[model samples]
Target: MSVLIEVVTDVAADPGVVFDLELDVDMHTASLRGSGERATTGSGRRRLQLGDEVTFHARHLGLPWRMTSRVTAYDRPHRFVDEQTRGPFRSLHHEHLFAALPGGTRMTDRMSVTAPAGPLGAVVAHLVLAPYLRRLLRRRAAHVKQVAESAGGRR
Candidate 1:
């Protein structure tokens, strides 16, 4: 079974700035400091572009995990998508959308995740993974908001 998670955040910055920050690996790692997430391969420590791939290493649920994702879609300052090529889950797809707002920008993240183990995976995904991922996404959004607001909408 696949789980869909959607998150929205308002930032005091331009859509372009928020969009670029979202693709910065260093910013991502910093935002996930609690989980010890780090970019280990591919576009680590850099801004990602279309077709760029990044492998992340992190500790989740008390276990180490690695996921490699590639940027499959790109629309500067608007939207982008990344899908897992290799990961712990059966499949993972993350889409990020940005829109200009009167005061700032509205950022939305839509993630689809599928766990392994046939029927049992669906249960686990609903009961555990979904909530956990939601929190992580919230944390990431908060961090981005803070940075974008502080940087005055500049990259």
Candidate 2:
């Protein structure tokens, strides 16, 4: 079974700012500092765009992991999608949505992950991966919100 996770965050920044931050490789690496996540290939220092691919190396669950994802869809300041081309999981899809609010922006993340190893993988994905990923996403979102709301974050 594929596990789906969704998180919503409201930021006191413009939708354009939020969208640009979301695609910033440096910002993503900084946000996941606890995981030691960093881009190893493809777009590293610059922002990712449609048709761009990035390989990320990170330590997760006390193990080193690598994943390569390609941006398959992109609509500036609105929506984007990335799908894993290679990773531990059988499949991973992430969608980012941004909506402009009167005062700021609303950002939403939706992810679907399918593990390998048949039934055992499904059990692990539902019981273990789901919660872990949820927390990870939450932490990342909080970091983005904190950054976007700061005066220095304005573009």
Candidate 3:
């Protein structure tokens, strides 16, 4: 089974500014809502780029979980895509789509995931993981929109 979640918001700023902020790890980390390790800890290889691999240490469902993602595509000031190199899911493909809106950029995040355990895993994911992930992304997307829109996309 494939799982997808998305959210959209308007930013009253320049698209370039919004895009730059999204790519900045430090700037992005500052706005992330969570405790302790929510902020990135890795250095040297911290920058996001094609073929660059990063292990994100985070918590979900009140338990510690980690995601190892490989940057498969990085089109600056436009779009990027990442795939799970390791972690819980059998496969994960996350694509970021952006379009310049009237005043800013209309950003859409598309996430597709395939679980393990064949057919049975799909059911388990729909019942348990899907809801948790949906809520988690909703919170995350809101944070991103707030940061982007408040920073005035022109900055």
**Model 2 TM-score relative to the real fold:** 0.94
TM-score of each: 0.96, 0.94, 0.82
Against the reference, the lDDT scores of all candidates come to 0.94, 0.90, 0.69
RMSD (CA, Å), candidate 2 to true, equals 1.6
Q: Report RMSD (Å) for each prediction in the order shown.
A: 1.6, 1.6, 2.6
How do the residues 46-146 of candidate 3 rate in per-residue lDDT, one tens digit apiece? 45667766676666667787777777887876888888988889999988766787777777667888889999999878888778766655665566677
**lDDT digits (tens) for residues 22-137 of candidate 2:** 88888889999988998954755479999889898999999999999999999998999999999999999999999888788889999999999999999999999999999988
| Winner on lDDT (1 vs 2) | 1
**Model 1 global lDDT (CA atoms, 0 to 1):** 0.94
Q: Which ten residues in a row have the lowest lDDT in candidate 3?
A: 35-44
Q: Residue 153 lDDT in model 1?
A: 86
